[model samples]
Target: MRFWMVFAWLSSALLLAVAQETVLTDDALHKPITVWQRLASLAEVLDDIRKQTGVPLRCQDALREMKLAVYVQNRPAREILEQVASLFGLRWRRDDDGSYVLYLPDETRRALERAQRDDRAATERALREMLRIAREWLRLPPEARAEAMAPFAQTREYPANMPYSAYLMEEAAAQRQMTQEQRVKALVADYLSGYSPQGEPSKPKRDAFFSEEDTQGSLLHCLSEAGDAIVNRLLEGHTLGFSTRPTPDALPLPPRVLLPFWMRHAQLSDESVLQFDAASGQFTEVQPLPNPDWGGYWVRLSAWGNSLEYMVVALRVYELDGKTQKFLNKVDYQLHLPHQEYLAETETWRQWEAWATPMEDWTARLKERTPLERPKPTVNNERPLLAADALEWLAWHTGYPVISDASRYVPAWYRDSLDSPRALLTLLSNDLWLRFDPNGYLLARHKRFWTLNQFEIPERIVRPLEAKWLAWQWLSLDDYATLAAAITDEQARGFTRVRRRGSIQFWTAFDNDPLYYELPALRFWASLSAAQRQRALAGEWIPESALTLPQRKLFRAALYREFPPPEQLLRDLPDDYEVGLYVPSVFRSEGVPESRSEALKQSPDAPAFRVLQQNPVSELSVLKYKDELGRRTYTLHEVKTQVSREGVDWKKVFQEAGYEGEPAEAILKTVLDTILQFALPPRMFEQYILNQSRYADFGRHAAP
Candidate 1:
C-alpha cells in the first residue's frame, strides 16, 4: 500500500478532542512597552520580548517557525498579541498567569461559560456540513466511488497557467512587462520540464526515527505554515472526511515469533509510529528542507491593487498531500503553482507595505438597489456633524458596511443635503478617493510614495507625491441590542479593552476609524496654536510630555467620550470573526509605513495630513472573487459611493463652528480647479498618537 494511504487512517483514528482551560491574570496584556523590531521570525520576536520583559510569549508547534514583520514604537502587549493572532484568524486566551496560557482571547475565554451553549450551537453547522459531504460520498455505489476517484488516477498536466504571487512578480514587473501572449509563454517555460521530473523523491518517514535503541540525528520538529501554499491548502481542505480504516498488514506475516517482554526481537526498520515518541524539542536547530514541486496553484487572487514593485525576499512552496495530511517536503514533481514564499497579498492587502485599486475603470454602484430612506447625520450634541457620524448614520439607516482608515476627519456643519446615497457618499469623500477596493475605503496617494525598478516613475513625478490614507472605521454598537451583546460580555471578568460610556463601547471593531467620532483628535488639534501645529508637521512635534498615564487616560475619556463611535456598517459579524483594521501600507517603503514616523518630508506621521487618492471610473461592478472554499467572500454585499465634487474649507468651517485653533491648510490644498479637500488635520493624529506615544518614544523626540 502507498504511504499516503496510512495518512487517511491516522486522521480518522486519531479523533483527538482538544479541550483547553484558561485562568485570568491581572492584565499584563495591557502592559505598555517601548520596542522597535523590523523583519524577524515569529519566534525571535516573541523570544526577544520574553527575554527583555521577563514575560514569555509563545505559539503552537505549527506556527513557531513562521516569519512576520512588526514595527511598533510604543503599544500595549494586547495589541501585539491580537495583531499576530488576527493574521491567521487564530483564537486566543489570557490566563491568570503572566505567561501565555492559551491561544484564544481572554475575552473569548471569559465568555466561554456564558456562550458555551451558543458557541457549541454555532459550530454544529460546520460539523454538519462536513457530515453532509461524507454522506454524499458514502451514498454512491462502489462503481460511483470508483468513478469519483477516477480524477485522482488520471494523469495531470503541469506547468499550466501559473498564478504569480506579489513576491515573484516584484522583479518580473521591474524588468519590463511582457505582452499577454509573451507573458503566458514565459510563465510556462519557467517550470523546466516540470510535468516530467527525472529525480527520485526523498522519503522522510513520518517520525523520522528508527527503533528506540537506533539513535540517529533528530528530524524537523516543526514546520512554519509560511507561504501562500500552506494557508490556501488549509482553507481549501478545511472539511475533514469520515475516511475508511487501514487494510490488514499482509497475508503471511512472521508466523509465531513470540518473545519475552524483556527480549523484544524486531527488524531494525528506519521508521516509527510516534513523533520520535515526542518529549522535549530543540526548534532552533531544525534545518530547512530543500523544496517541493507544485501540485497546483491558488489562482484566486489577481495582481490588481498591489503596487507591482513588491519584492519577494524568499520563494518557498509546499504541496499538501491530503491523503497523508503532510506537506511533501521537497519532491519536485514538475507540477507548478506560484505560491510565493512571503505573506500572500490578500483581502484588500495589496502587498506588504501598500494597497490600491487597479488602474482599470470602475463606476460605483449599490449591490442593493432597494430604496433606503436617506437619513441626515444627527447627533445628541448640538456641535457640527462629523464624517464618521455620517458613515454611522448612513450605515444605521442602510445595511451597507464600510471599511475606513484611522484618519481623522475635521468636524464641520453639513449644510449640503444628503438626499441620495451618491450625494451623501460624495460629500463624505471630500478630497479623499472614494474607491471600490472590492471594498470601499476613503483612499488616496501622493506622488511621493511610488519607487524603485518598477513604477520607475521619474524623479520629477515622484518628488511632488502627496501623502494620503483610505479611512475605514472601528465597529461599534449603539441602539441595537444584537450588536451590543456582540461587543462585550458583562459576565466576563477582565476590564474591556475598548472605549466606553456606560453601556456603549467605542471602536469595538479592530479598525481605528470609528474612534474619530469617539475621540476627535482633529478637533483638538485644530484648537492648538499655528506655530505648535507647523512644528509637528516638520517632524518635530511639540506637546506636553510629562502627563502621567492616568492623566492621559482621563483626558482622552473626558474630552472624546461624549462623541459617538463608528457603527459597523454591516450587521454584526459572528463570534471569533471581527472586523480587522488593516493599516495602510506603501509600495516602496522600507517596512510598515505607520511604524516609521520619520517621514516628515513627504507627510507628517499624523492621522489627518496623509494621502488623498481617487479616480472617477466609467462603470461600477463587484469583482467576482471567491475564497479557498469557493464561497463568495462577501455574500449579498453592496456598496454606495460618491466622490468630492466641490471644495470646502473644512478648517474655516471648524473656526466658524467655534474651534479655538488654526486650520491645517498645508496638509491638503486645491491643486486642481475641480479637485477639492476638506482641509483635514495631521495635527491632531500627531496630537493623538503623540499623547499616547509621547511618554513611550519620549527620550528620542523630547522637547529641547
Candidate 2:
C-alpha cells in the first residue's frame, strides 16, 4: 500500500473559537486589593484579569512564558498593575477604550529575533522530512512507483488561443514521464538546493520555490498532495468528481507486501458500486473487480449543498482473488471545487440560488429597457439608517438578500424620486461595489473613506467615564429593549440576559463604527466653551430635549446598553426586527465636518484615517473602449443620480428641526440619505415634516 493510503486513515482535529469568560467586579478597581501570593506567571495573572473583566490582553508569547513572584498589600488594580510593570521592566498603556496593553523594552527587536530563529528551525525540520520521504520512495519498485504517479500524469490541455498553451503542453509531457519515486526525489532536491546550491555554504540559500516551472510544471509540483491534485484539476478548466474516501490504492502494492490484506482476510462477494474516471470526470456503471482479492475500489461524487467551493465524494473499497470477492470498507471525503468548475457544472437556477449572478448577466440587466418607478423618498423619525443596513432593507423589499461586508460605517440620508431597480442599484454602486454573482448573492465592497480606527477612539471610550457621565442604568425599559433589538438580527435575538457588575465600562464595538460616532460625542464635549462645558457638567444641557416629541422619544430609547445590571427587562418587543440607533452619537454630537475630520487625524497611530482620506477607486464599470496601436483606452461609466444628489445640509436640517446638539455630520449625512432613499417608511414624511419646528402650524385645517 502507498504511504498516502495510510495517511488517509489518520485522524485530525480542528480548534474552535470559544469566548473565555472573565469575572470582574468593582472591588478589583475600587476596593483595596490585597495580594500576598506565591510565585506565579505574569501571563496567568493577566489571563485571570482578562477573564474577569472581559477585556482582551495581548503580549509577546515569550513574555507569557516567563515567571514572576509578587507579594503586595492592599492596593488598587491600577497601582498593582504599575507595580507589576515595574517588576518586568515593561510599560503599559491604556487604549482609547480603557483596555490596557503591555509592551516590553525593545519588544520589536526581540520579536524579530525570535521569528528568525523559529524560521531557521522550521526549515531544518522540513529538510529532514523531505530527505526521509525521498529515501522511502526510492526504495519502492519502478512499476509500483509508475503506477502511483499515473493518476497525476494525465495531461491538462489549454484552449488553443490561450497564451503559453504550447509551453504548458510540453511541460505536461515531461511530468508524465517521471515515476512517482523520481518526482519525490526531484521535489526534495529542488527544496534543498535552495539553501546551499547558489548561496554561501554557511547560511541556507533562499530562492523561489518553483522558479523553473511554468503553469503545467507548477501543477505537477503541487500534485504531491491529493487535495492539491483535485483542486488543480479544477484550475485546469476541467470538471472533477470529488470524493471523500479511501478507495483501493491506485498505486501498485510494494513487492514486499505480495500477499494482499484482502486476500488473507476474505470478507464478502461482489456488491453494487459506482466508478469515477481520473482522466475524464465521468461516472460509469458498477462492475465486479477483475481480481477483488487484489484490492480494487469504487467512487461516487455529488454536489455538496450551497457551497460554491467544495463537493462531496464517497469511496467504497472491495477485494477479489481467484473467483471470490469481498467488501472491505466505505468512506467519504470533501473535495475542493473551484468557483469556475462549480459554475460550469451548475445550471441557471442553481447558480442564481446562491446570489452569484455572472458579470455578463449583470451587464444585461444594466442595459435592459424595463419600466422604472419614480418613487419619492420620505423621512422617517422612528429609526436611524446605516448605508449598508439600508441597502439590505431595500434589497429585502425587492426580493434580494444583500451581504454586508463594508469596511466603513456610513449612515445614508438622501431623498430620491427614482425607485427603479436599475436606479437603486446605480445609487448603491456609488458607495459600494456590488459584486452580484449568478449564484443569487451580492457582496458589498465599500468606497474608501476616512472613518475611524482603533487608535483614534475618543478618550471617553478608552478611559473610565468622568463623574458627570450618565450610565446605562439611567435608561428606561424601552431604551434597553430598543438597544437589545439593534444588536440582534434574524438569527440571534441576542443574549437573554446582560449581567453588569457596578457601572461596567467595557466597549462592545469590534469595528470602526464606534470611533466614527462615539468619538465625536466626546470631541463635541471638548469643543464647548468653558461656561457651556461647566453647564453641561452641572447637568443643565439637554440635547435630546431639543428634538421633536416623537424623535425625542426614539432618541431617549436609543441607549448603548450591551451590559444591563442585575435586574433584567422582561418587557416584550415586536417580533419584527427593530431598526434604531445602536450608537448614541446621533444624539450626542453636533454634525461638524471639520471637527470630525480633525479628530480623526488627531490619532497618529490610526491607519484607518489614511485609508479613509484617500480617494480609492471603489468600483470601475467600463462602458466603451477603443484599441489604438495596442494601447487600449476605455470610457468609464458613471451613475448619474445617487443619494448625494439631494445635497441637503443634514446639520442645518437637524438643527432647524429643533435638535439641540450637532450630530456626527459626516456619518449623519450618509445615514440620513440611506434612510430617506431606501429605509424610510411610506407616509411617514407628513408626520416628520409636521413635527419639524420649521414647518410648525402648516396647513392645520387642510386635508387630514
TM-score of each: 0.19, 0.19
For model 2, what is the error of residue 653's alpha carbon versus the real structure, in angstroms, after optimal superposition?
19
What is the lDDT of every predicted structure here?
0.27, 0.30
Clashing pairs counted in every model: 46, 53
What's the CA RMSD for each of the models? 28.8, 31.7
Residue-by-residue lDDT tens digits, candidate 2, 1-704: 43442233221100000100021223344445443222234566666555644566545555563433233334455445544553233556555666566666574345335433443333333333343543344344545544443443434455544433234334545755775445545554443221111111211111111122111121122222233344334333333321111122232222222111122223323213334454553333232222222221111111211111211111123244554322223121221212222222222212123222333465564453432132322344222333544454344334433333222234443224124455445545445445553333344433321111111222222222211112211221122222333332211111111111111112222212222222212222223345543443342423433334543333322222211110111122112211222211222223212221233333233111110111111111221343332333433222221123234454454444444654321111111110000011211000000000001111121111
lDDT of 2 at 101: 65
Considering every candidate listed, which one attains the maximal lDDT?
Answer: 2
As a whole number from 0 to 100, the lDDT of residue 263 in candidate 2 is 23
Report the backbone clash tally of model 1: 46
